[model samples]
Target: MRTIVQQGTRCTALAGYVRPDTLDSALAARAKGLRVAAGCTDLFAAVRGPALSGGILDITAIPELRAISETPEHWRLGATATWSDIRLAPLPPAFDGLKAAARELGAAQVQNAGTLGGNLVNASPAADGAPCLLTLEAEVELASRRGTRRLALGDFLTGPRQTALAEDELLTAVLVPKSAAAGHGAFLKLGARRFLVISIAMAAARLDLDGGRVRHAALAVGACSATARRLPAAEAALAGARADAGLAAAITADLVVPGLSPIDDLRASADYRAAAAVTLLRRAVAGLCTGREAAA
Candidate 1:
């Protein structure tokens, strides 16, 4: 961490490269309009100019922003926690969807440095984390000098490359309520080859069973919409369904098509994405019922 030069409660790091180890100092830098960055995996890649555009508020130095802790009511995933952190954490099977996405977020190096905050903040329509988190009913915590607030993950992303985060507010944590963490979850994506490829379609699902019947179901699709979205209609159909292959097979392409808004992109046709989403979602549920990994 660099020494902060405080000017009337406002702060700046060396050459304006602010790396504050404390939340207060971080907020102070943010208040000054320094770009808040963690991991910077996207930042560096998106930079086309000879040099970076401006000074950055590096939150990675803040200890509280890099932890994954659990409470009686919820699991708290700090904003700067890396993909590797989630993949390696001893979380319950309910987080299998997130862990599956975490493992395939990028190459090993990107997973080591790409953060949950960066992924959400980037707000890419195809972001793997969004579908997984959405299925888990995650909420995001935003902090500013004025106060702290939370927004459901669905409300956080407004559109492609957009979010509800205010200019002065920093995304501090992601919360998964205990109520939404009752079931096993799975994530799957289809791409041209597989490793290190951007998603053509992606799906995340969670299933909670009771007496051999599905008690709760959540299904989310990404890369097939302007923003990743949860399919409550499809979820409603899955509720009370038997936990078996037939049930999984019932998740036809039409089942999730209404919930998605896929477009014809260079990677794949919109119809293909819609169909792939259904297949992935079905496989996810099938794997859960049969006690196999969903992301085969």
Candidate 2:
């Protein structure tokens, strides 16, 4: 452990930098109050005003924390897997929504350096990746010197900028079950403008069709609540519905409106956000249906 003094005009905060090449070492460093840093995309920006207090535990060098792998039952994305890596990985169709979200996360520079674990840990209400991951029914893996634990993505995110991560635990990976990975997916984001803008509202949809009817539906909306939430009512309505434009008709505002708790922000009004979330969800599901049609 190397102690470094961050010099600031107003105040200086002492931070220790530790580059751990192994998972055990990284866990031990985190146990000692060192802030975890993988991509540093968010960490550096956050500490720009205030000097870093506790040192940083850099886990990017750990090979075990950087590999993406698949098992018979699930796909495991390592903590250090960057957005760019996810966008380029050879994943199933169910990950299409996630890949689309990955492409729109900031710019090429940010995506190249921003890791999936960092995005989830940030736990922003408007995070582009959260809606897609929520719809995919992803689970987060947390590890400490004590042992490892898994939490559903919904349970892992408690509120805006908050998560279930313990001080001594490190988010090791994200797991997507095979059942959730067996569908066609689509993502739609509503922003003030086109490129490099935060979402006013965004939706991700995954649909599994059997005999031209919807057998399974997963839909989630973001930027409209303290945390992104799945629309269970709308998903239930879509069951057995024709997997075509007619599927959009089953997704009424009433079904999704109840699940959203939008707040008035500078970017948009609460009512506007609610409306946009409903529209985005309909479009996302429609897009999935259209893509399936095209493929057929």
Tens digit of lDDT per residue, candidate 2, span 178-250? 8999888888899977768888999999998889999999999998888999999999999988998778988
**Best candidate, TM-score-wise?**
2
lDDT of 1: 0.86
- State the lDDT of candidate 1 residue by residue for 1-296, as single tens digits: 22111111233368758887789988987888878788888887775454555577888877778788888788888898899989988787889999999999889999988999999999999999999999899999999999999999999999989999999889999999989998799999999877798899999999988887889999999999999999988888889988877788777766689879787889989988888999899888888988833432
Clashing pairs in 2: 16-55
For candidate 2, report its TM-score: 0.93
In model 2, state the lDDT of residue 46: 77
**Cα miss at 288, model 1 (Å)?**
0.7
What TM-score, over all chains together, does every model reach?
Answer: 0.92, 0.93
